[model samples]
Target: MSQPMIDPFGREVSYLRVSVTDRCDFRCVYCMAEDMTFLPKREVLTLEELDRLCSAFVDKGVRKLRLTGGEPLVRKNIMSLIRNLSRHLDSGKLEELTITTNGSQLARFADELAECGVRRLNVSMDTMDAAKFKTITRWGDLGKVMDGLRAATEAGLSIKINMVALKGVNEHEIVPMMRWCHDNGYDLTLIETMPLGEIDEDRTDQYLPLSLVRARIAEDFTLTDIPYKTGGPARYVEVKETGGRLGFITPMTHNFCESCNRVRVTCTGMLYMCLGQDDSADLRAALRASESNDLLYDAIDEAIGRKPKGHDFIIDRRTRQPAVSRHMSVTGG
Candidate 1:
């Protein structure tokens, strides 16, 4: 009864990214508008529902499950979902159960997370400068996030710091951020800003190519290519000077779509086979349509069959519209 989820491109879907909620504590300039409208509580799936959907994916050959969110830790009683899904890791059906957080709530839940079988965490920290961090996240507290990171490190969670490479904003801090992460014994990943959702600023001005970043990094540090992957699009290199690893997720400068094997589901149970595409399958309707999971599995199979070969992500200066109108948070990024 273990049916493999394969796309039309013959890519076996082994990774699932589920958005536990679309709510967050900070309003990052690139991610969301200051004034945002969130979904009603009734519209969002319950913790129990999330566990069931995740379990279904595990049964269908998803070896890794990552819980994302506007900020995943902000979800109420989210640890319960993590605890429930830990059963898969216990049974060896799932290779990993991880969470992508903003480090806002890690201080409160790090120990519980470690107890629930979470070995790794991805924390989005754009800049180390307090003023710059506030300007980027709008409502974020650098002190709190740092405290959370310390707690997570103490709790035995391997942390990766994700920094969005913005052109004029925080570009100067890239090297400093890398050094800070390396000093703190954390891996650093530089991501090219994707054209997702309509924000207050023009993305053309915000878009920073990783090619330029790599060139700048090469000037300072020696980087060696390494065969490293985390079931995501980031390609890795070992920093020879620091003896640490660095990852680059270049969706714009480079396309890693050929090896794409992951799908994302929103908090409302919408399944997106491709991150840059808007097409989604309504797993909620199928789940509520019946108590049994036959419809849910069938829905997932249909969605995978129609998965596009690659996403069409272009940051046009004239248009100034996002490649996808939905925010990265909405798509579980």
Candidate 2:
């Protein structure tokens, strides 16, 4: 058996988040800018390249794989890629393979995804309000997303809703969203908006703290801490009366970097050590030049050694400036 992939901080890096493409269908205001430019087809990694890279990581004992994207489903023949990666699970090289999507095309692909051994999904749905959903996504059909959700559930896929809380945008819908999830027996995760990129609106103005969200939920139901491990950074809690669980991902208010156990590879094959920092290694060069996996492994090991102790995301009180400036879409969020 191969050795475990451990970073310099002694954290076992077992999860790999791979961005298959940089092209997305919806233009969520917080995720992309109006005049966004996508990578050329020649620049993005091919399916074969992705398979090789993922295989290399699997060889190093990385067992959990998450396929992210500009909207991973948008990539042509994504089901084929899913089927290919499912072999890792079949071979016992991977513990789980999940996907994070916008749910735009999930309705059509849900059945096939389940057939290909994809059993878990994280769908981004910020609001249930039709008009607000369109406003947040720039041009999204709430009806289609809803249908997709139902389809995924019917296909026997475990679905989780990822709601990014924004101050004036969808903060008001938090309780309603939670209630809907509870009623439908679906898990919900509320994520704090991070200062990842330059959005059309001021990120500071829209930033909503998870603490406030938790407090609001407390008024209606008693939240009990739950013991759960999903290999991600969300803190899970149970609603006392409803029995439904809620996950709160507080990257800003609470820094979970000390327990960070994953690395991200962008569409262009750049390995990002931390989401809130600009520290990354160019894996594309190594992959293209090397005949063996030694160079790629060495490069990954080197990058992990240089991983910062933690991300510097706190706003400087004096300067009133955010630390990170990259866009979330590019970072595979």
Question: What are the RMSDs of all candidates, in order?
Answer: 0.8, 1.5
Q: Compose the digit string of candidate 1's lDDT tens values, residues 1-333.
A: 447988998999999999999999999999999898999998899998888899999999999999999999999888889998999999999999999999999899999999999999999999988999999999999999999999999999999999999989999999888888999999999998888898998888888999988998999899999998899999999999998899999988899899999999999999999998888899999888888999999999999999998888898677677888889888887
Clashing pairs in 2: 196-326
TM-score of each: 0.99, 0.96
Worst 10 residues of 1 by lDDT: 315-324
Once superposed on the true structure, which residue ranges of model 1 sit more than 4 Å away at CA? Answer: none
Error of 1 at 68 (Å): 0.5
In terms of lDDT, the best-performing candidate is 1
Q: What's the TM for model 1?
A: 0.99
- Residue 192's lDDT within candidate 1 is 87
lDDT of the candidates, in the order given: 0.92, 0.87
